[model samples]
Target: MKKDIEIPKVEDISVAVVKEWNDEKTEEVFNVYLINLQNKQIQNTLVTSKGYGENQSTGEKINTSVLRHFIGDLDAKDFAKIEPIIEEVFGLNNEYWVSFFQNNQMYDKKFIFLPETICDENMINVPLLNKKGVVI
Candidate 1:
């Protein structure tokens, strides 16, 4: 019975972590965004993000507070800013669990940025955001 459920695959959706200059703050900052690349809209979008990992030097396990964002809807080829991320958590494993509706069906996926994966070396010109960052 458990295997009878239809779980449609999630495609054309992405989560990007962007590093950009915040003119008002006079410093660079990290921000998260939810991108919809499907031919249709994404409705009732919800994203939950958190960071967790062990400190390399201190050997202490670290876990950041989990934050939930309700983005509502994202039009085709459009995107929505999810949250602002602090650079301090870059050393941890950052994860974003995303769920939404498309074509009246529910789909979800989990994206993880491994430790130190958000560095400048891995940055790319992210779509829609027009800034350099990592996307997973």
Candidate 2:
């Protein structure tokens, strides 16, 4: 008898958070990366990101910073990175929204950085969404 096997799904794109440091390692900057993991290129890509947090006294969300980019084409297995202002997106209560288009299809993904994830690691891998609203 043959046993059934499960195949894992592969993602075409990925988003990640990285830290850039100066020579002394004391100065650092936070960055976001959009990577194309597929074999083919993605065309007419646009990326917009925003960071927000809930108010301490009011329970209302507030915007911290906004970032946007447009790329004609992103080559296969390549990536684009944006370095946001460190103070805008580094707070413990902050969350981010990253939206982009690949091959004319839109993908929007939200990421929340837990204290442990960013504090202990130099790089943190975030999630990406596909056209069907599925995490890729």
Q: List model 1 lDDT by residue over 39-127, tens digit each.
A: 89989999999999999999999999999999998999998999998888999999999999877888999999999899999999998
Q: For candidate 2, lDDT tens digit of each residue in 1-136?
A: 2456543332576655655565688987555566777887777666666655665678787775556677557788787764453544455443445455565565555555543345433443443312111111
Query: Could you say which candidate leads in TM-score?
Result: 1
TM-score of 2: 0.58
Determine which window of 10 residues in candidate 2 has minimal summed lDDT.
Answer: 127-136
> Among all windows of ten consecutive residues in candidate 1, which has the lowest summed lDDT?
19-28
Q: Return the lDDT, model 1, position 26.
A: 91
Per-model CA lDDT versus the true structure: 0.91, 0.55
Best by lDDT: 1
